[model samples]
Target chain A: MKYEILEHTADLKIKAYGKSLEELFMNAARGLMSVMYEEESSKEGKEVSDVVLETSGPDKEALLVNWLSDILLESDTRNVYCFDFSIHTINEQKISSTMKCIKSVAKEDVKAITYHGLTIKKHNGKLEATILVDV
Target chain B: MFSKEILQKVQKNIWEIPKSYREDMCVPARVFASERMLDDITTDRSLEQLVNVSTLPGIQEFAISMPDIHEGYGFPIGGVAALSVEDGVISPGGVGYDINCGVRLLKSKKTVKDIESSIVDLANQVQRDTPSGVGRGGELVLSQDEMDELLEGGVPWIIKKGYGLEGDEEFLEQGGRFDEADSSLITDHAKKRGRDQVGTLGAGNHFVEVQKVHEVLDDEIAQTFGLFKDQIVVMIHTGSRGLGHQVCTDYLRVMVQAMAKYDITLPDRELASVPFLSKEGQEYFKAMNAAANFGFCNRQVLTHLVRGSWKQIIDKKEDLSILYDVGHNMAKRETHDGKEVVVHRKGATRAFGPGHPEIPKQYQSVGQPVIIPGSMGTFSYVLAGTNESMKQSFGSTCHGAGRRMSRKKAKKVIDYNKLKQELDEYHVVARAGSARGLVEEAPGAYKDIDDVVNVVQETGIAKKVVKLKPLVVVKG
Candidate 1:
């Protein structure tokens, strides 16, 4: 399983898993998109706009937040909904990726990606992370 | 992570975790909640977050959490902290993502009986006229110059544009504008998101509800505030929308990076902040004020929309007039106990007592009106600030019923159809853009507002003036 939505009292939480760090980030992005839209159905044959995002953070966790935040900003500015992501390169300090988004309305406003109870760790020989998004 | 063993009950409805509870805490943490409410409050990390807030530099007295306190990113929702401006800090998280997320009450001469037959039509009309739901922009699209003026002038600019009525400024908090707001400090991206969002109500708990005065707790105060039993009122709850969110997102990044430069360390990245006097801090303050202005203007335009909607169905003589508007999420410079401090109220309302010069001239003899919106299908309230509030909670009070269950849990347990049926049984009409949204906001998901209000009144923070029951709810 790539991701699972978890119960939170006041926000949206997702637990995503991947065999590799890149896959973990990809799954996390998919999880966020899923929360913002109907991920599976919205992805069918829609016109896509490809854009690159580059950002640096102090660590992997911060980088993940920055990466997702950049995408959120782009989504708001371009008035589009992102459905897919490809992480070309990612490290402790920086990341570069191409996002595939379609022009569509968001189902809900994901105000910001929160750092509360945020952790990206490896367990049982697989990478896993739990993220909280303030809605 | 906080245990009940560590909390000392200070009084009947108050709990305290002293400064000694944590080594990093600069002050104590005080919580106002009933015994029953405390049980639910202890189920989450809200107390832990309150302790974290107490660690901020220059916090005075205590890091206080209201009866409606809930877990949030940095400070718990319904949290209030007064930080000394001389050497304290300003954290965006403290004011929340939605700057100036607030409540405004408009009283109408028409009573529930007068509009009983038209409640459903009024609900539908409001939902249609006021742009709501997710990603829905209002009809007003502003140019850069116009956006700048609106950001700086707030309700006055909107009124000049013919979206609001004259003399409306007197009924708003801060006169609906912050003179310190600087449009230049706000980012282009933030402006882009805000340009077309004015007068729009975004999703997630933001709403326009038509209500009736169910009971008058204090007849004199109620009469003074122009509220009578069974009288109709309109309540609008929203914020600066995408603009405020972006401003917070943008500044959190800046403060996070600047933390190293200033050699400041925090327990949580969400608490990232700079000294109030720092250049970055001032810039954020100005930008936040500008966004707050956007929120004020946004609600003002919606007020105009509501007035227009009401006029179509009700008589012209039954005009709607502003009772009061208050910002629940904000950080403002104020004096407390002879010291200047920056007060941050997140999911909390300011309730300045009588004789405060900041209050309107008409209400100078009484206190500021405190509008506490209940959860959907629940009983709301109109209260007045007290001098005891000024002494105890920095003139702050609870903002709402507070959520007992998460949205996910609400969706799991509440059938949308059944929920709608229940609202119908209560004669409370509800209209929403999405059924799922309505399910997520089921009234069962929230705490008993009566219990919450009782705690506030018993604690002497605010005095109850009137009780309001929702007659119609229009949501995003």
Candidate 2:
């Protein structure tokens, strides 16, 4: 599993796992998308649009927050559901990705990606991070 | 890792964790809650978050938490910190993502009997008039220039546009507008998200509730606020919607980078900070004020919509005047103990005491009316700020019942159909956007509001004025 929902009292928290840094970023995006649209059931006649997202920060943790924040803002402002995150390039400070998005209204709103207790770590040959999202 | 044993009882309902508890803490961490409430409080990381707040530069006296304090990202919800403007730092995390997420009380002359027959229709009418639910936009759309003007002008702009009744702005904090707001400082992305969200009640604990004055605890103060027993009133609980959220997200990134330059280190990155006088800090302060203005204007537009709903179902001539509008998430300049400080109230309401210059003139004599909204299908309260609060808690009090359970736990334990049936049994006409949303906000997820309020009253921070029970609840 790329991500699993963690119990939080107020906001939403998720732990995403990846085999590599690029995979970690992709999985984090997927985790965010899963929360916004819980049921990934149908895709009939949905408008498909190709879009690229790029964000850079001082470090990996900040980069992950900015990346998810970019996706959240794009979803809210454009009213589109982002899915299938395809990371073309990623580093400790920057990430670039192209995703196939569907023209569907979001089922919910994830307000912001927070850096509270955020740390990217390697464990048992897998990269993982616990992200707190303000909903 | 916090436990009840480490805390020392300061008074009847106040407890303190001295600065000795943590080597990094600059001051003590104080909490206002009864002994019984400590069991629930220690179960979360809220106290540790409070300790983190104590370590912030230039924080005054002690870091304070109200009875409703709950674990949030950086600062705990229901946390209050007073920082010296000259040396203190402004953290976006301190004000929370939903800037000015607040509550406003609208007083009507009619009693419950007058609107009893139309309760269901009234709830449906309000649900139709106000745009709510997740990711929903309102009918009123603003152009880019108009959006900037709205960000600068706030509630007065709404009044000038004929969206609000005359004298509506007077009852709001800061007269419903912060003059320090600079619309140019607000980012384009924030503007884009907020342009059409002026009259929306965003989901996740936001609502427009029709309540009745079930009990008048203090008749004199209740009368001063134009509330009476059995009187029907409307409470609007919302904030700046997506615009405010984006602003916080934008600044948190900026501050995180700026922190390295300032040589400031914190226990949590979410509590990033820079000196209040720094260039980046000033820019963020201006941008935050702009978002705060947007929050006040959002509620004002919703008030206009709710008024329209009221006229359609009840008497067309019925007048619904704002009793008070209080923002729980904000940072404001205020004087306590003759020293000016920037008070950050994240999930905490500013309850300026009686005769405080910031309060409305009429309410100044009795103190500001602190509107505390309980969880859905629970009893809310109207309390008056007291002088003691200024000395005790920087003129602040609890915001709500505060979450005691996770959303996941609530949904798992609560049956939506049964919850709806319970609301029906209580004569509450509930209009929810989603069944899952309704279950997540189940009253069982929150602490017992009555106990929270009793702690506030016992601490003498705020005096109870009246108790309000919902007649109709429109959940976002």
Considering every candidate listed, which one attains the maximal TM-score? 2
* Model 1: share of true interface contacts reproduced: 0.77
User: What would the TM-score be for candidate 2 when compared with the true structure?
Assistant: 0.99
Candidate 1, residues B1-476, lDDT tens digits: the string is: 56788889999999999889889999999999998888889999999999999999889999999999998888899999999899999999899889999999999988888888888888888988999988888999999999999999888888999987899999999999998999999999889988899999989999999999999999888988989999999999999999999899889888888888878888988988899999999999999999999999999999999999999877655558999999999999999999999999999999999999898888877799999999999899999998899999999999998887989889889998899899999888898889988998888998889999999999999999999999989999
Across residues B1-476, which tens digit of lDDT does each residue of candidate 2 receive? 47889999988999999999999999999999999999999988999999999999999999999999999989999999999988999989899999999999998889988988899899999999999998899999999988988888989987898889888899999999999999998889989988889999989999999999999999899889988999999999999899999999999999999899999999999999998889988888999999999999989999999999999999899868999899999988777888888899999999888898889999979999999999999999999999999899999999999999988899899999999999889888889998988999989999999999999999899999999999999987
C-alpha lDDT score of every prediction, in listed order: 0.91, 0.91
Residue-by-residue lDDT tens digits, candidate 2, A64-128: 99999999888888877788788888889989888877766676678899998787899999999
The reply for model 1, stretches above 4 Å from the true place, is A42-46
Give the CA lDDT, 0 to 100, for residue B402 in model 2. 98
Clashing pairs in 2: none
Best by DockQ: 2
Clashing pairs in 1: none
User: Candidate 1 chain B, which ten residues in sequence have the lowest lDDT sum?
Assistant: B311-320
